[model samples]
Target chain A: MKLTKSFNRSLWVFHLNTGSCNGCEIEIVATICPRYDPERFGIKLVGSPKHADVLLVTGPVTKKMAAKVRRVYEQVPDPKLVMCIGTCGQSGGVFYDSYNLDGPIDQVLPVDVYVPGCPPRPEAIVYGVVKALEKLERLEAAQ
Target chain B: MLTDIILTLAGAFLVVIFSLIVAFFLLGVDRIVTARMQARIGPPLTQPFTDMRKLFTKENVVPANAIPWLFNLAPVVALASAITILLYIPIGGFPPVLSGGGDLILVMYLLTLPALALVAGGFSSGSPYATVGAQREMVTMIAYEFPLAVVIIAIAWKLAVSGVPLPFMLMSIQANPVWGLVGPLGIIGILILFFVLLIVTPAELSRIPFDTPEAETELAGGVLVEYSGKNLALFTLTQGVKTVVMASLMVALFIPYRLSALVPAPAILQPVLDLLFYLILVVLVAFVAVSLIRVSMARFRINQVVSVYWIYLSLIGIAGLLLVMADHFIGVV
Candidate 1:
């Protein structure tokens, strides 16, 4: 993982939904609205995982989505950060202990930053990104 | 002869570096201007630089299904061909470094090389999305070529009938300002042709409103879905260079007048004034063609793109061509 200041400033994120309700996804969209304007920090929502430096994975991984999630995680180029958004991805939230369960995301792929809420507010998502940035900066310093 | 060769080599090196810098600067300006228009504070002007640097540090992924050599070759070819086009077109107040080596016809063909390289890359990536994108890109290239050819041929044709030597050469075109060659009716014709060319610029560069090949919402980055890291960065740079190419061509053909020619300036400062004027002209053309059109309109469907250029714009171009022809006949009689 080659961490640099440039990487921290311009993190192109690819959002993946692993079968959560659409709540987290809507919040993710809101994070990019003109009011929030994540682009000011050079953070953009790219369409492809290949172009992404940060993977914003929403939802707890359903059995069907676990493999796809893993593939997407792999697709992102190295030195990547994964943020598990919403409580569902952290511990299955409302879906906890379900019969078809395959995730709390971490079980399926490495999780770097977790934003926990039934559906985290857009502010929480932004703060989670700041935390991710701090982690990236720390990694840069350690190098 | 040796000195000529050395000077040409030096000029090529300087122009490449200068074009790269100017391309990035124009892209940054486009983003900021677009952001302001949308009522949002945009990223800083240095954002594209940071994005390019970050991409270089990331892993360069070669998809398992891809033809690695062709996939890797695409970006280099795209960027190189784009810069090659710049070498033949006038820049600022100076004539092209390789002005006599190639002319308008060669430039029209060179203009297609980057897009062809893109299509080649997209097909080689082995992604279903990339395949679809490549098809759409090819369609776009064909759709725009008619009006583009019409505009170029009309100008050259007009110059030829007027008995200007080497009408196909950019130097002759610049020297004989197409605007001055025609009368009232021809001015209207030239304006129409200019308008058609302006509409074609965005499609040529594949920016918004005509960016069907990379439609993020529908195809998920389309032709670029499988590209990552350094290859992606180079493609981004190629896009910037292509924007400069299209804008410079617009400047060369329609708005070739120089600030130095308009106002008497000291010999040394003349090029400086002309370069600044040229930059302003490029920015204005880009804003109208790329940024304004991008913001005001939504993407056109692939079929709509074909009809819009082939049927509508071609008609407008022909109308302009006819007017120019009429102006010539009327003048000769």
Candidate 2:
């Protein structure tokens, strides 16, 4: 619906894992499958942050990955959005208050959307993406 | 002389525009067919256009260690050289823009320019992944070069032996469809050569099965890891154009038949019929060589790619050449 912004339709996502179990990653893969087919909306999982319009971050930040996450965030050029997936990246999930914990991802990056669960369902992640799109539209309107 | 120069310049401009459209069509068909084969409704046909527009507007990032000038220049050279090949190779119903100016050998050499530019860009990017990718790409180029040369040389040899003038010329090749010249034995030979070229097509375009150099999963975009924004957009455009170049080459070589020739039409509409038929051929080639192969096969290991081309495909291509040679001698006897 945001016709003016070309990136609105073609959103190339880069997936980053600070250090959670692979639950959110599996769900993300499911969302990209034939049934969900995010590619129908031109959403693709890109290999490099340089190629990404959206950064999908899963897992809580471990001590070492904190800097790596920030570096990748910097690598994704301007007009970028970050979505923190799963409760691990939101409130640290089961790893809450751990010694090696560097985050809740919001501490490390500006998260535009948060889909929280032990590992959020694929549908919930897709809804979170819709929310991200809405946020993008609002920002465009403000501009 | 001045008018001639003006005519050529104008013609060249038209060819550029025409090839770009065909290139976009090839990309759209590839993506949509790939999606459908996987049982999903794909993105719109104009997805490439939208993606290109978005890439142009995105920020161009020159990595800290990259040689900025070469990094920027590579994509321009790649895209320009890709368009350059179209100038020599006849497309649709029309003669090549610079028809008779260059020949098959020149086009063959020109085909390497874009890939060379890619290697230059990859090496210039100063990333370890890109360095490895550049090397892999160079190796892939070397591996496939022999089989491709075998296919072209065998065709031109047949034409030359059969008393055709300027057998290497694109016009000559297009004017005389190869299928007509050969006996049944030679027909089998030509089909094998055609098969060789078809397998090589994916490798030439760096699609799946031969996409080790740009292995997105392991190498993280590999040779293109450091490329972004307008530079990346230009590279993507180069890819689309190269797809058309390969498809056009295959169509011009194997299936040069014009629908207009079979179904008589108005003089004005003949070119339209020819162009439409050419497009269908191009799409079919792209589907078989790019989309279908890409969907069915996973990426080959770089070593496996080398063996497939060097050991297996080269042998197959040589056997094809031998059959063509044998058929020619037997006909004379």
Candidate 3:
């Protein structure tokens, strides 16, 4: 019970930088700070998607990162959430026309929330995380 | 009534703005927290603001097949619904700028509006990816709603038995945590709620492991395949505001201890200080949530999600409810 309680309270979020200028990546990092506090939502960023309840992917889906991104997505267990952290991840943003881009993060895995921005704001990321957590709980209930 | 509406409108607007401002700062905090978790230095506080400004000036586009009115309306509804939820929920002694007949149950449904709007927008886009996202969203909706509802219902039962008749709105719950969080059953309900709510947070916000609908790798932008410019910005803003809303909701339900100094102050200062205090608590909640994220892993399958919550959370919630009832009968309150 405690484990389940803690598991629910502490949702480990992972970040996958498929390919971007590092703009959204930095913002993603900003979300966990004391100021933005993703922890309030029971959200944290894990180094690996395997340990993440929510995999937060930033940047446009680049061809180079596609397979790796997919691999990471596969590693996350069931009831996991995927969040496309930026416009790039959503629709490729400015990178959409780039030959190296693979389109959006949703193309690779299911995304519960899409925080759209060339790089979205930290609060937006937090909001998106909360939404995903809500989705996670709802899914848990139905089962 | 007119005066009340005006006051409510004013309060709601302020809360909306406050939520937005808090969201940007929270974004900065999230970055810093995640960075430190990984042993790295994060960006400055103004980073999110700068990014938003940059996006505001970026090019806007509308897809040919998309319903322009609905597409434009989607993000607006999302933002509005989030802000509206915030308004209805009390943070500490603060009642939503507005309150009505229903309680937490109403807030729960109101919260789902943004997601519903997203699904609608996605389907309206007429793209395969968007449609797929909508479908995933629907499934996700089902996956999470039951457990959330169970938790809410349990809490409501507690409130009912206590004869407190909670506003069913989050604000009333927050204002009188003493009344809301009363009894051994209340505590158990809260504990069960802790798990249930924790699970609900990510899915509701559409964050990770469960983010299949908008999975960049599979559905591209998912529901947002064709959104751009202001429409996209609205969605982004909705996300930001919703983050604050979610955190605030948790704090409202769990931590209702208020700033002792605020009550003695002037009425105008009272609300401002109250708002600030609520934001601080939300920050704390976010910090705790982030710390938890550092160690946990995301669940992969949709089925697993359903099974875990339904089989586990439901039982837990039910147990808590029964325990509460027993405690009440035993005069253990």
Candidate 4:
């Protein structure tokens, strides 16, 4: 589905945690601080995936969580984006190639933007959101 | 007669549009005020409009197990009934389009229609989370209903006791301005009831300190867990419209005074002044009932919700009712 500027502006994101050690989760929380205030851009954290336009995935996918992540990705309505929020979701961070692992999140779901830090800072999360909007613009231009 | 009917239909259409504009503006103001209270820059005032556009264009998803017909109908019912409420209550200096002798009671009963639509929607969604939410919504409705009734009846009863014919008419209540009919003791009582109704406003809107049904952290959107796209957008609209309805009700009941009376406006300018003044009052009332308390409190447990309204607010409402009655029978009202 082609994206519109309205879709880009009012991005309702649902955060998914597969197997993060809580580092990225803390940064995600920090991104909502009065200092950061993502709401100024109309970025809201919605509880239901069905109401979301974007999914923020953090942490490497554990074997037990792989299916749940897939289920959640499908739960979001059409015209969606998946943003990988930490290095853990890209290369498993310190847990790379460990037993009981099933990820790097891209293996289980299509990731549109990756912010690669062991745990990215809140500033990085904000940049990741900007990059996501740029990607939307690219998609709109292509159409 | 046919032309008359067409004119009424056209007028009703215009009023519905006006109400929708006010409702959305109220929601945007709410977000901005809540953000400022938290020391954050909020979304633009046009954010709700942007959201509605995106939602209308997005894909509408129906849960496989859900009853499709009922699911689709719920949102339409919810929005329609909410807008229906705006038509019965007086706006600015104009009488209600459908004004009648006892339509205050009609407005009270109509207040429950949007809630009932929500309950129906939740029950039909076929999700365990929604089922729990529907139950909580039903419980919240039952808990808040008595005090709501008490508040309305107290004012009307005072009007009756004060010798106004057709005391149940909103026009009568508008003419009387319950605040003036009461002496000092009754003033205190009316103030108490005013406070109780302010507290009840959050519950009626399912806002925080009473928002267990949609507790996001726990139930993941609860009753709305399964709704998506257009359906969710309609429910969102219903929420904004309901806020306007509750705030308007409070305005009509307590502060229905017109600015034209004070300023002595010419005939051409009377409605313009009254309309501007009415909007200002609605904004203030919405700030108090919806935004202020929402920012100040946390969600209540379902059990606590029941006891708070049933035991605490009910007693307070009855006390106010008695005082209004007493102020009439005794001296200085």
Candidate 5:
């Protein structure tokens, strides 16, 4: 994937919930609030996968949601980054041994960054985004 | 004749560049001002430029279900039509490049072309969200057309009655400020018309309160749900240019006065002053019609959009038109 300096500055994110408890979703919303003001970094929450540069996935994928998650990941255009937020997406946090287990996200799609917490704080999500940008910068430099 | 053609071409190129720069600058300003209004620090003024660059570099995706040719053709058509409107409408102390070839009515028609292109793009995308958006866009277009026509026709009709030649010509309208042609009651009528036009400007540009077609929350970017990368960038540019076109039209029709005429400036400085004055007016109109209204109000439902334009705004527009007419007849008697 080709990348440029602009790719680092303006990152449009699309939030996806495979089957989270909604705690991570609320935290994601908090990250966008004026207190955090992600807009200052030119980060925007776009409505569609087509418009997104970053896929912000916030859940442990269930059997029913794994296919849908992959489809959405495909829907995002090339040169995209995926960040799995919350502990559920990292190790299925609370539902680690559930029968319908299909994901810790990376099983379903390649994730570039991971934010581990029961429900990661807004600061951690922001830090994860910073790390994602660092990865993008490294890729840009390698190119 | 060859030199004339080359000069005209060069001038057209310059206008395109100038309009693009100004439009992007205005967009950035709108973002900053909106953020301030919301009590938060906004992105830098150059954010739109960076965003555009990123969009241009991203992968262009063509949905499997989409008609590639028509889907791609729409953004090009939209941008072209938007720039074409600028060729006819006077900009910043300069007469339109194609002023002699077209007039107000032609401009009115040209205004619809960009929106039509958008609708075409939406329908061709083969996405249910986009299809619904196109239908809503068509409905919004139909709703706004009447009040828009009323405002334009009222001014031209007033000019025609006053024995102005080529009443529908934008040059003629610019030469004769609509404000100077009316009595006290007619002035009130013109003010009312101006207010109606201010309300129309946002709807014309598909901003908030009239952006039901692109309701990001409900429709997931709606008409633009399927577009990506380069095509999306072109649509964004088209939007910025369309804002310039609409604001410039408002400036030409209602506030065509030049600073050069009012103050004694050196001949060299006159155009500069007038251009600055014109820019100020355009920005003011944009701030009021777009930013202020957008900040203060919520998006109207598509049905509510139709009623607001067709019922409330149209009634206000006609009342203003009658006032202008009554003022004219009252003066004659």
Candidate 6:
């Protein structure tokens, strides 16, 4: 019980780069800066999806990546969170019209919170994350 | 008012410039860190800036079938939205230019507009790659959005219930103490919040783990497959600025300290020094959290990604909320 409590207290996040120009990837890294100290909030980034409670995904889904995206998403244990990070992830932004790209993330998955930004700031990401947690609790209570 | 505007603008300019520099530094740091973890030397810190400059001078190409206006507008809007977020945040104890009631919510919405603009821009291109990228982008957004929203509301609720007498604006939370991520439950809430942010951060910026959208190995640059020249450069700049903005927000909300916290310096000097301090701190955190994780971790499947967030993390969030509520009731009783 204590283990579950502590584990509940600290959620390990995993990041996945579907496909991006490395722009959003850098921003994602910025969120972990000491100034942000998400750890203070008991938030951490884990090395594997199996250990992760949330999956942070960026980039527009390409057909080739679809399987990989699905595969990784499946690897995460039950009751996980998925967050699409950039405009590219949300709607493929500048890549929307490309033949090689898939449409917005929703076609493949059900998103809980839409954190829109070509690349949202770390704080915005944090805010979206906090919001997602609240939503999760609400959903669970109802369930 | 004029003085405030001038100060705010100057501060914003500095913030934008600094954020870009920091972004470049992070890119280099990330590469070096990853390389070190993998037993190699990484690219130079200035590589991103150089790459952007080169892309700027490269040949500008427009798709023959694309809507020229939308394509052009996409990058501009993305950049603008990123800059706007910078202006609204508190850095080193300095409030943003547009700080007001529920501005945090506004910031939240504004952050996503750039992505929406990008999608529109891609759709305007009328290319298959761009279309596919847009679809994938949309899917990823759909997958993670709910959890993100829940996390935000939790923090806002905590602040609101704590009896801090300001609007639940992002700026107010920064300027006051009630919004601080302090308390054990708050810490737990923040931990879950952090994990959710960590996962989404890559997706928000389209990095590894959640980087399936533009898998060049698979999709040929995904959404940006057709973009080149200045348009690409614009996208590059926006990416850098967004990174800084994300980092800054974390500093404002989680850390919430400024140069002013160090000494009784003049207000102007304090904000500047605080901004610098915040940036340095961001650099340090990146070294551990992102750079380290990217090098060590691999990616996950899309459904697994969705289920974990919706089911698992949400359950954690529920527990946290219940604890908080219990704490609140116990305190009242």
Question: For candidate 5 chain B, which ten residues in a row score worst on lDDT?
Answer: B91-100
- Residue-level lDDT for A3 in candidate 5: 94
Candidate 4, residues B1-333, lDDT tens digits: the string is 898678767767977898889988999999999999999989999999899989987999999989999999999999998888887888999887666433788888888898888999998999999989989999999999999999989988888878888888888889989988888889988988888888899988888989999889888898899999999999999999999889889999989899999998789999999999999999999999999999998889999999999999999999998887787767842
Query: What TM-score would every model get versus the actual structure?
Result: 0.99, 0.98, 0.66, 0.98, 0.99, 0.65
Candidate closest to the true structure, highest DockQ: 1
User: Which tens-of-lDDT digit does each residue in B1-333 have in candidate 2?
Assistant: 899889889999998898788788788778999999999999889888888888888889999999999999999999999999999988788898888589989999999999999999999999999999999999999999999999999999999999999999978988899889989999999999999999999989999999999999999998899998889989989999999999999998899888988998999999999999998898989899999999999999999999999999999999999999999999999
Name the TM-score of chain A in model 1: 0.98
The DockQ figures for the candidates are 0.90, 0.58, 0.03, 0.85, 0.84, 0.02
What lDDT score goes with residue B239 in model 3?
71
Q: What CA RMSD would you report for each candidate?
A: 0.9, 1.4, 14.6, 1.3, 1.0, 19.7
> Which parts of model 4 are misplaced by more than 4 Å?
none
Report how far residue B91 has shifted in candidate 1, in Å: 0.4
True contacts kept of 5: 0.75
lDDT of 1: 0.94
Report, for every candidate in turn, its global Cα lDDT versus the true structure. Answer: 0.94, 0.92, 0.69, 0.90, 0.92, 0.68
Flag the better candidate by lDDT, 4 or 6. Answer: 4
lDDT by residue (A1-143, candidate 6, tens digit) is 01222333445577888887777778777877655656544466655454456788888888788888888786655556788888888888998989997656776766667777877888888888888777766665565
Per-residue lDDT tens digits of candidate 3, residues B1-333?
899888877887778777788878876677666667655555456555554553343345555677888877888888888888877777655656766654677788898899999998888877777888888887887778887787667666666666665536565565556334466655765776766777677667666656667676566557866664456667767877777877877787667667755367866677677767877888877665543453355534667667766787677767766766676677743
On a 0 to 100 scale, what is the lDDT of residue B58 in model 3?
Answer: 36
DockQ of candidate 4? 0.85
For candidate 5, the clash count comes to 0
> What is candidate 3's lDDT per residue for A7-126, written digit by digit as tens?
445565667778778998788777766677555434555443433456777777778888988887765544456778878777878766887877677777777788887677888877
How much lDDT does candidate 4 score?
A: 0.90
**For model 1, what is the alpha-carbon lDDT of residue B158?**
98
Off by over 4 Å in 2: A1-4
**Tens-place lDDT digits, model 2, residues A1-143:** 12346788888999999997999999999999999999887899999999988999999999999999999999997778999999999888899999999999999999999998878899999999999889888888887
Instruction: Sort every candidate by lDDT, greatest first.
Output: 1, 5, 2, 4, 3, 6
TM score of chain A per candidate: 0.98, 0.96, 0.86, 0.98, 0.98, 0.89
Error of 2 at B264 (Å): 0.9
- Considering the two chains of model 4, state its CAPRI-style docking category: high
Query: How much does candidate 6 score in TM-score?
Result: 0.65
